[model samples]
Target: MPHFCRIVKSGIAAPLLAATLLLLPPAAQADHADWHHGLSLIDKLKYAPDFPHYDYVNPEAPKGGDVKLSTTGTFDTFNPVLDKGQPAVGLALVFDTLLKSADDEISTGYGLLAEGVSYPADISSATFRLRQEAKWADGKPVTPEDVVFSLDRSKELDPLYANYYKHVTSAEKTGERDVTFHFDQKNNRELPNILGQLQILPKHWWEGQGPDGKPRDITKTTLEPVMGSGPYKIAAFSAGASVRYELRDDYWGKSLNVNVGQNNFGSISYTFFGDRDVEFEAFRSGNSDYWLENIAARWATGYDFPAVKDGRVKRESLPNPLRATGVMQALVPNMRRAPFNDERVRQALNFTLDFEEMNRTVFYNAYTRVDSYFWNTDLASSGLPQDAELAILEEVKDKVPPEVFTAPYKNPVGGTPQAGRDNLRRAIALLKEAGFELKGNRMVEAKTGKPFSFEILLSSDTLERVALPYAQNLKKIGIDARVRTVDASQYTNRTRAFDYDMTWIVWAQTLSPGNEQLDYWGSRSATEQGSRNYAGIADPGVDALINKVIFAKDRDTLVAATKALDRVLLAHNYVVPLYYKRDMNIAYWDKFSRPAELPTYAIGFPTIWWSKNASPK
Candidate 1:
């Protein structure tokens, strides 16, 4: 899967909800003596401490050969913690996390750098004992100090990490090889598993003087690859154009059970192209080894090349079996801006989108309309709120839109010309209600006569096709909506600063939605720079419902709370919901061999695959 700053669950499997939380027996709860080799937020772990290898990997797979992949956009930094620059793809390969997630499970993680983890019954603090054999690339033993420094430094340097680790009070070295993370509150079962996702950094390498004899700053971007303790190390690179990672033959954990069948390539190289079109051309010309097709139009008609015909290149549309299709990709209207702040205006904008036409024409009828913020998931509210969901919403009825309880939320349907005209009339009436009147071809303020105009900021030209049609619809209402395409870095900076009237944004959801919901829709994050609340949502109803979601006591309450949040957010029209596909379209060369059954949650490419004819380098 491609790396987005925001964490998202990809695939169509039902997410692990509150109901999936394991309930321990009385005897098990009574004894605090037994420590665990892994942690899970939902289901009980499937692997034992002495388990040899994961079910989805070939333990005896040979490791050699090179796999060349292509990526769009340029990366100027090798640092993964910073939010500003585009970090190199696959940088995670060079760093080790304290615990590694099993791809087949929704919420289980086995110890990677840590040998064991222990927590009290109340789950306030978690203690991890570092593996004695763990060592950095520079041959320094991985220590408790490194773990503590990583947590504190990450929280200080990145807002995402700060929000993710907000409840975590401090990480202290309890023993020579043991580190304990203290939390401000207890009973957040997800916290321990989330902490396992921490990508540990070598404190000594980062704090030491660089080649230029200057102290290295963790907050700044650096092209000189820093020392890491993972299976691969940066061998060579051409700044933004390309980067190659050479496998560490003497890696300490290569033979570990969690790593036996993974990182099979001796070296992995990523070549960057300016855009998807050029990248596709490079792949077709045999310059790149793999490509994950995202464009429906291209997927339907662009695979007639000679390589594919000759069977050298393969195309596959695989089913995502690990997660529910939970994504809200939309034209996010910045509520902080004028006109958009008005609920009537935001609602009117949604009336103008013709998703049915877009899917049929541009998408080759490959996508389904995204009706809910939590689309294709149990968390999505369907029909009108009822039962437990209704009970939750009743408390906030006075504060939310009345229609949230009275009518089911639905996007305006438009397929034919007549349907489009009817929807446009409805939109015009809503705009008129919001104090705007169509004057000839321009919608202007009724009193001051100021033209209603805003630019739809875009990062890729591929989106121009989708935005241009939407702009045409907005133009019908006399709204001067123009599409402006910029580079990825510019788009990242502008969106991070919340400096646009309207822009394309995606909020990816996970199986167990927890504290991250605060960063996504919390009032505090609305004003925070580099926050993910792109719509600038700060509703009291949303904030209250998010709390309900964060501190939900059981599966039933969590489900009800999540549905309530979904209903309120949909009612607000913060974004014009777009479309999503249930399947992942991917293409790769035929030189690699993979397990018969892939992991449930991920593509498991590169990680659980080996070259057909290769040996250890």
Candidate 2:
């Protein structure tokens, strides 16, 4: 349940559920008419009402030792949901979600903080009944008031969450532990599941005073430890360097069938570094227990250290077959700017970069060139729109690019010097068509003589490798592209505000696409500050298609609508297509043991893997 689109670093009203909370009882063997223990999006629940622990977990996995990890940025606060400061990692371990997503299946969730959840045939609303045992760290039972407070406050605080919960109009207490959410629209499947993904907050704690003897404000950032029903709490920390969470000895839900073999760590710690090289070095030198490597060059050659060769450190590539698909990993140009406003100008920039040559020279030839906004999935548009997808696109033929109907969209190709030259020539022609002319090796507006130059803002110095090469390529095409690398804080602030001309961004997608599409490309979000509409997409066709996806009647319609939307987004060229590797690159210390079959969609690292030693000492 990637509940929302993560910037590859990493759903709104996405009727993402299509059946997000569809509870089909084995005994009943029919449609959803009553509440059940498990929740799913399929015709039948993956785990039956009387099912034991999940199949992917070790029912008796020992849990004692700690796991150490690394993060490459500084954090100023523990309030992750707030828009204010950089929230520390490991905060997720501190809070319990209303439901748990199934690893083997897609768009399914099981009650975690709540014992069970109920929804109607129309899916206009969902009611969650908290477990009697669910309690905050301070020993307060999690009530309907807490659940209501969580939903109302989250939408009020962040625009991202606002877009996610836009259709959800109100929440109220029905029964003793029951909290009900009413929706503004009907049949929005994703609303239930994303709401199921809600991390229940403690209203009693936040309404009270902090350690400093002042009333706690949920809207503000804070370093004071939070009270939660989850298995971990802040044990120790430095302001911006490190944070450690100790497993709660009295965690309320340890015995819950859904939590079996999970939360195995006695303690979990995250050490922060300012650089990836330093972070990798720390993981290599045994400062940390595991390393989920994302850089291809490092995975190819950086493991020359002795530990990797020896049995001490293990390097393995895990494939996530059930992992959610469709990622636009690209240098996204801000559409609010003058140069990027023209479709031809954007296409010209896409032709300038040589991804194949870059892959051969820098990426170790490990990745595949991404073509579709939703690549590696059935939902991605292919050779041509046909049948249902074609019909969906024809509705707003005028609002979208004509090529979306007449021709298939593909990135301009380049590998050799000749191919690169040919692409640049095409780029030149496109620029000319867009009323820009090459003069003295500088691209400028042909009529007014306004120079076209923009900076590619980047957060990590490590990404400088990719940006620098692309910028050099652009320079060859008479476009002055400068690369500027800043610290994490500045990068976060700038990107959130959409301040750069272009920046490396990753827009991740799940199998079930819904309301979050509006947040990504909606017309209203384009002008709204802090919205994720990074490319400034404001097309009525996109909005209509997005609504189609959100309100898609069935799974087939959702897929077709998603494909139509993907086809339109690509035809417009919002981001310069980048590359992606399917297998997860991971290196870890050989000190832990895990289930023989891991979750199909996730690695289930420290959370599910227990130390072999099984000793806190």
Candidate 3:
């Protein structure tokens, strides 16, 4: 029979447990004492240099305990189609991805449901084979039907998901154990990575609503799907407040070596808070076990906990994986708007902001000033290119000036200033030459009655803290800049729909940057709502160049094409490159630890684990 354990109410450590223990008989009280003391043993292990990578073995590792989790912001939905964070956290234990990047070098899909997937020579089609032993949480066979249902449902539910599924023309079931995906494009370079985001929902549970409830579809069908081939299944959920997932005793993929290190808890419970102060208090008083420090200032100076001084809390700053973004933040210009439509105006805007000052003053000297849109990475250009490469970039040279491309913004007084006051003067002069003038302290186009007044949206706490200094610089240039703050959900909605005038955004232009460049600065992508084209950029030259890069079969050609594209983007000043954070700030309870062999990519959690003596539920 399944063991019956008390459902520990969600929040900070409960005082009721101690009172309940005192009321029990002598033998029961002794057992309760042992359990309480055993749980406290976690503090002893907290001082260990490293935590065990694999700690979820049944019988080998004790089971039937809960792992309480707390995070800021509640979820409105569990569907990944609309939500990115909540569903991802829940799905990490409740659902398995087809392909997962275990480390920097490999992309593995050691069949939880599907054994292996491969691409053909043409690179247009991919074939997947299922592991014979894979089964759903309810002990039913997981077949190709479930995969197709998930794909179709995702696309039908939201168009944003359809954009992600655009490459796959169709998902065809070859046999009971085999399936194939045909892409519309020559290659789906990030196909495996994309697959990791597509979690399978049970067709059986989804066809009809379960007891816990499900989302209503366009057809007015309420679908509740809890069936999935993962380590755990949702036992109970409180809409946005909290969610409880229980470990599946007869999990199909348990024996696989890949499954050993992840999903360590018997039951994983998550509680959400809308405020940072509340979340911090929860962490300080020992409610939340882990915290991913995104705010630099908060990480550097906010905490002076006794636990930290006493070495009971561990803190480490790790690098952010380039997968999230090439650069953390950038100033994007609306190319669709006039004056900014001119190449000179765009280049002038880029020259106006002094990154060096912004880095030192605004960032508290914690960041590296960025030059290229794709910086530091191999995709970025090192020096002047050869004849053929120069020719391609030179074709668009007439529209842009050499000074704009090569020279740094000149200042009247020596030394770099964060706002670059002299650069702002040059920018104003350039706009004036391009039929723009300051009217009542606002930059307006002489030909058109349009004013250069725009809004800048940001979501990061650190960005919010430092954005004022940057805003002041724009004001100095006689530009009307409005800074708007929003939560993660609102931010996602605003950016996804291309509903804002201007914004501070970042895209990690990784090592093998792909042709999705079209999405950010291309004509085709601008027409589509919710496209990554934040500034409504629509350049024909940019589109053609992106196409060339995408089709280039050879690695050298691809590299050269990418460099050429980067130069074009820089010269056009599509995005004003900002600064990159050199340090990664992460803090957690001392009981947790990670391995020494770190990957080049930022660690997102596949490599992290807890010590044996961690708190028991």
Candidate 4:
């Protein structure tokens, strides 16, 4: 859910996470020893408890080689708990969660740090039995105190953590290796699985003095490499220039069921570049081993290199048809501001956007217009809301827009000059009805004579191609639209404070979306600083619909409620929907070998892919 300013996402292929803030093991079924090892919400656990390794992994895969990846900006802090500095990629490599989620399964996970877990029938509280083998880099045992400290510290430091784990009321060390998390509410199905994903921090090291002899504050950002208990540790670094990790031979979980053929790299490294183009060039030059291509034009035309032509570089479009990604990549309008706060003004902005023209011109026609908040999923509403979806909407019919019942939500089409003019007239008419007037070829507020204008804030100039044309369209309708590009930090800060008139925001959603819906669109989070509610949505109907989604009894109920919510959100023009890619476009040097099968939802890159340079035994 946009990471609430902490994790600025760049990869479109990054999944709508199973858990909102972190990846987690699947949900547990009941309170028992058998249920301790694995969990599932709606379906049977895919892999048995005694399974040796994930089916998508090479159970006997070789484990040695170094691979370099590319990053655009510098990373200042190694501390991932704070919202301050950009946390480096592969931070997860250094830490471990209680349970690990299998890639192919949508709602199942197995024990990792925790050997077993127990929860109440109602799922009010969950107890995790820590593996005695788990140890920090310095050989200190991972304890229940560490788990308690991790939860309290993370919630205190990161807003995303605070929001994600808000339902977790308290954590306590119940036994020698048992840490139990108590929930504030009952029958909230996703809590056990979410709590299992709590990234356990080493309490002793964090509370102690650092190399500077200063007591470390988890709330503040730091460059000091964190002490962790995972498969790899920070071996070398030059701040943002580059960072390398050495896989630990002494790693505690090396022989576990989940770790059988994973973390096979002897070393993994990342090099910083000026931009994505430079990064791609680095990959083409064999400096980095892998690349995820997002630029449509580059993918369609730029891969004429000799390596690609001769098959030295492998390119694959990995498509998972069953994956349901609820992604909204759009221009988010801050409703707290004027003109945007008015429905007519917001609707007018949508009419000004000629997606078909923009798709052909800027995006190389490689994208599908995002039609729903839950697009590319069964949850996306179409035509008229019928049956269950209709029933759900009827409860809030008065609270939502009247057109929701009378009209289907469809973005205006404009590729031809005639269609463009038609859409332009529609936009002007909406503005006129909203007390705006086109005087001397410029729209001004009828009450105060202020020009209909606002800035389109962007983090990178890559978006200018899209925003500039949109700005031109707005100007054509006698509205003054300005475009501004700033650094990622400034863009994040401004958006966090709700200071921007409009900006690019993406809210990635999972197939099983729950609790986090509150942080996404709840009225309470609208004013809350560091919320995923970037557009400041606070409609009563939205609030009611979100609650319905959160409390959905079964899968059918969840889908219907989500579709109803989508309809209401579309009815209001909070975001000018943009384009989205359905599949992952990836290219890599032919120096590595992955399992014959890959994870269902993700590409299983460096994590599950092993280097082919290792000697066969």
lDDT of 2 by residue, 523-605 (tens): 99898766788889898989999999988887889889999999999988888988887777889999999889887776778
Collision pairs in model 1: 13-323
1-617 in candidate 4: lDDT tens per residue?
Answer: 21112443323524525432112242454334343577665566777769899888887888889989987667778896877776777788899888887777776668899988877666678888999999998899999999999999988877778888898999999889988899888767778777767788999999999999999878788888898999999999988688899899899999999888889889999887656677888999999999887788888999999999999999988875226567778998889887788888888999999999988987889999998988888888899988998999998888998888879999999989999999999999999999999889899988888888899998767678889999999899898889998765577678768889998887777777777788878898899877778888998999999889877777799889999999999999888999888887899999999888788877788888888898654
- Taking all chains together, the TM-score of candidate 4 against the true structure is 0.95
TM-score of each: 0.94, 0.95, 0.78, 0.95
Question: In model 4, which regions exceed 4 Å deviation?
Answer: 1-13, 19-35
State residue 523's C-alpha deviation in candidate 4, in Å: 1.1
Tens-place lDDT per residue, model 3, 547-578, is: 65656555576667777776666655666666
Candidate 2, lDDT over the whole model: 0.81
Per-residue lDDT for 302-336 in model 1, tens only?
99988889998999887653264367888889998
lDDT of 4: 0.81
Reference-based lDDT, each prediction: 0.81, 0.81, 0.56, 0.81
lDDT, candidate 2, at 251: 93
**Candidate 2: Cα lDDT at 420:** 95
